[model samples]
Target: MSSATRRPNTNCIHSGTRIDPAVGGVNTPIHMSSAYLQPNPQAPETCYPRYMNIPTQQAPADKIAALEHGEAGLVLATGLAAITIPILAMMRPGAHAVFQADLYGGTHHFILAEMERLGLAYTLVPETDPEAIAAAVRPGTTLVHLESPTNPTLKIIDLAATARAVKETNPDAVLCIDNTFATPMNQNPLDLGFDVVMHSGTKYLSGHSDLNCGAVVTSAARMKAIRETAVNIGTSLAPFDSYLLERSMKTLAVRMERHNANALAVAEYLERHPKIGAVHYPGLPSHPGHAAAARQMRGFGGMVSFELGDSPEAARAAVQRLSVIASAISLGGVESTITFPAETSHYKMTREERLAIGVTDTLARLSVGIEDVADLLEDLEGALAAL
Candidate 1:
């Protein structure tokens, strides 16, 4: 079947492959070569690793393009590399962009620290609705970047409306979304009219917490620009990791099903607990963004953020009490983890800055894993009771 018609699970394993003519291997072989045969020595990067044209790299990238329904895609060594390269490529000096206020701390910090030094300008839209995003667009805006089911807060953006917001406000501006929290199985931003979709493959895409990778998928024209920037910057995914990324993605759909189910169960339980003040989960109707999230996403995703007591100390103590869910920084692994946003992802943001976007000290993000629901619930109950 064509990639477009293939079911998601089938596409995960087969979308990027061609029948092997060499050894009939089921998987893409890692090409460790630093060199490739150059009939015209001038084009030395025709099939080089750094250029992201090697078979191992292309296979997974092609898989992402197929899964995301984008014309092209690229994988890189780290999520930051995938995200920063495209933003930098699109917004040169004097250009401006509008960013969603609640973003991955790394991305948010990059804009704050580098935009001025790089001679670019940006506006942060506090509200996630399409109207608010479009209102922030400057006259010379070259990009509008946002995340749906936003980090730490779980605020959902209307992808279709947001894409329209960018097109109507600044036809020239590119709309990019960080789809890490909403993996490809749950949402495909490109189909919603987004210009580009990027992900921290270190999270959901890797699933196992073993690999650190990233991806950017967009139209062929836009990808050419981003790929050129990546080639120069040399952040392309190495062959071995590229191989691992593809291998890992084969079970993405399977894992996400469990993630979605467990997260909703956890969110429901948390919402009922007297110790938890608020539960931020799109799967729950109580969430302010539930309607928007339901309209845009196939699944509400595995992440659930909730209030733990009223202080950072209480949040820290609660995480420490969890014997099963390890306290960790990065998330989206097979093993469950709980961490305070104030201490990890958004720690760099000042208390004032963090609170401005609803990332309070009492907020703790639970990355619900594929563990048995009963066991996970017992662990959480123990933690909350301790707290």
Candidate 2:
């Protein structure tokens, strides 16, 4: 059976598997060429790395594309580039954008700083209800952007409802989501009605903190414009990084199993502790969006957020006490890490702005890794005890 038609776990290993013709190598060999020979000079199409047509780049792109059930995909130098290129391509003069306020700080800051400069008007929707999203859509809005299990907050956006609302309100508007946190193993936004799915491959998709990469998956029709923009902007990922990303995905299915299990166990432990004020993880029934997440997501993601206390000092002290989990900025690696959002991801936002979006000074965002649940729980317990 073809990999695409097979189950997702199988697709991870074989969807883009094209054996080396030079030898019977099991893995796709890295084609370290910037140029490829064209049979006809006037043929108009030629294999090029920047064009995202070469085998090395296409292999990983195809794997993620199939995983998300998208018709096409592209990898970029950074997650910002992957997301920025598509939003810019889809927007023409006089077109606007609607962005959910709870976002990765970089994306949120980009909208606030760059949209108007680029001549695109935007609306920031503060709420998650699909009705609110539909209500915010203007006739000229060309893009609607959101992230599920939102950064540092663990808020779940209703993917299907939000997509339906966006399309029904403005069919021309492209509904794009940052699927970085959930990863394809937990959720496929395309299957839930989203038009485009974006990922910071630096996170779960790469499953390691060693590289920086980004990916976009969407229908073939919409990707044409994004591809053109990306080529012009020179953001295509290198062959070696693409190869590594493809290899990382081979282990995604197995790694995420442990991530999901360990995360749930950790979140439950945190929820019961006297020091944890509020635990935000969809796996817990107490989470506000638990019902929607249960309906839409196959597994509650490995990320968890909680309130440490009223002061930022307490949050800082707790992280300093951690021995096993690193207090780091980036997430989704095999090693468990924690971040104080007030000092890291959401640091750019003013105190009032952070509070407005439910990001308190005490909020700690935990990227649960594939560690033994007992060790992870103990690590977190040691950290929280310092509070």
Candidate 3:
């Protein structure tokens, strides 16, 4: 089925499949060998590590490209690697990038450090105002980047409107979006006018915590550049990890449904709880970004962030007391995870900067899983009670 017409779930299962020629096996076999032999010296087919595109990697890349509604997709070793390599491919020395200030700490660190070494300049602005983003664009700015439902804060940037403004002001600039948190199930940034779409495939795309990978999906022209850079840098995902990501993608639709349900339930529960000073979830009516979220996202999302009336110590205690949820740095797994952004993800930021972005000592970020909603709520309730 073509991506244009196929449904999301069907794309998930069929996008990357190649039936076994001899046995008609439904699953693609893992091509573990790094190299392949050529048929002849003059007339050849698939011969080297650099030349061979294994079934395991190609199938999943095809599927993800279809699922993301992009011309092509390239896989990478990690989300940060996926993000940095492409920007490097597009940017020249002295080129500048304007980006949202609110982002995953890992990504934030990479951009800050790499740009300095590359002689690339950047401007980080609050994404809440489109005008602020426009104002940050300098004469040499060649890229505009952003994350919606931004990390820890859950603030939404109006993607379509921002894309339009960026294009209008800097027609030569490429607009890229980090679709990691939202995933393609909820939003298609390319359709909204983004030039490139990136994902930390280690998260919801893989659905499991085991594999760490990333992806860049966009138009074929852009994909060619990303793929060349990916191969040259040796950042492409390993064959086995690609296989795992493909397997996880097969259940994406169902997992997303449960994640949405559990997240909505948990957000509501936290909003009503006496100890919660503020809860930030796009699914909630009180959220400032709810309208834009409704327009763009199919489901709100699984990630939820909220603050308590207590201090950082109490927040740590709440996480330590949870019966089922684990305290960890990662998110978008089958099991729920809780983390303190001010300490874990965004620890690189100073205290003043963290607080400025609404990541306070009391703030806790939850990556809701597909577990029973009732059980999750009870676990959280018990933890908060102890706090």
Candidate 4:
């Protein structure tokens, strides 16, 4: 049967596996040899790890493609590399691109810092609205990049509408989405007309924080270009890391279910709490993007951002008092993590720039884990009480 007919959970487990005929093993074996002996010079060569696309690495790439409903995919060494590879591949000298201003800080920094050096021009749209994005597209625009349930501020964009608008403006322009905040279990941007979907597999895809990997899913033709670009940049995921990513994806569906439940519970609790000045979660009806998110997503996702009623100092104190959640950077693991965007992720941005994007000093970002709802709530409440 075709992968399209299989359920997500089934696809997660079997999408990429190629049983070894020699041992009849169900799992794909890791081919650790960097070099393979070639018997024929005329035939296409599969004589090197980077050039061959070995089974272990290909397995997870196939699984990610299946999950995102894309034609093909490439796994990379890191999420940042995943983002950079695609953008670099699609852009060239004098090419123009449009991007959301509230993008993940790293991406924002990359574009701002490298555009001139790369000989590309770009426009940063201040809002996630499709019309605003379309308006920013110039005649030279070659790409349109978007993020939904935006970082540190859960702003959801209308993917279909935006894709339509971008394509209308420049039919050949590529539309890319950073799908890290909303895992494939929660949202599938490719189905909504996006040309490319990127993920920080270090997050929910791995479930455990032990692996560092990134993924890009797109049409077969686009995948070919991306794979070539990745190989040249030396960003291809290692065979061992790919094996781990494949194993972790087997439980993606179950883990995301728990993440959804735990995050919704946490968001609701914070919304009702007296000390929270504001709560930004698509699951919350009061959130500006709730309706759009409901229309496009299966779940509202695990991330939640909220502000302390008092000040940035109070937010820092609350995070310091937390016992269950770790005070650290990076997110989307089995363990909950909290970080102040002003101090970590978006610290590089000026105060004015951060405020322009609604990332206030008091805002705290949360990657709610699969922990028990009661325990998570108690931990958060205790922290708030201390504030």
Tens digit of per-residue lDDT, candidate 4, span 42-126: 7785655675288888899999999999999888888888898899998988788999999899898899888767768899999
Pairs of residues clashing in candidate 2: none
Reference-based TM-score of each model: 0.97, 0.97, 0.96, 0.97
Score candidate 4 by lDDT: 0.89
User: What is candidate 3's TM-score against the reference?
Assistant: 0.96
lDDT of each: 0.89, 0.89, 0.84, 0.89
RMSD of 3: 1.7
Better of 1 and 3 by TM-score: 1
User: What is candidate 1's lDDT per residue for 1-387, written digit by digit as tens?
Assistant: 788898999989997864467788888888889888889878635777888888889989999899999889899999999899999888877788889888999998998898867878899888887999999886799999889889989988888988887789888888899999999999999889888899999998989999999999999988999999998988988888998899888899999999999999999999999888989999999998888888888898899998888677777887788887888878999889888888889988989989999888788899999999889999989988966
Clashes of 1: 0
Candidate 1: RMSD to truth:
1.3
Q: Put down candidate 3 lDDT per residue, 1-387, tens digits, no spaces.
A: 576799999999998687679987888887788766766768744633343267788777888788788988877788887788788788887788987888888778877777877778888896567777877776678898788878888899888888887777788788888888888888888888888888898999998899898888889988777777777777867778878988888998889899988999999999999888899999999999999999989998899999964787777877888988888878899999988898888999878878888999889899999999899999988988866
Clashes found in each candidate (C-alpha, N, C closer than 3 A): 0, 0, 0, 0
How far residue 110's Cα lies from its native spot in candidate 3, in Å, is 1.2
Q: Model 3 segments beyond 4 Å from truth? A: 40-52
Lowest lDDT 10-residue stretch of candidate 1: 15-24
The stretch of ten residues in a row with the least summed lDDT in candidate 3 is: 44-53
TM accuracy, model 2: 0.97
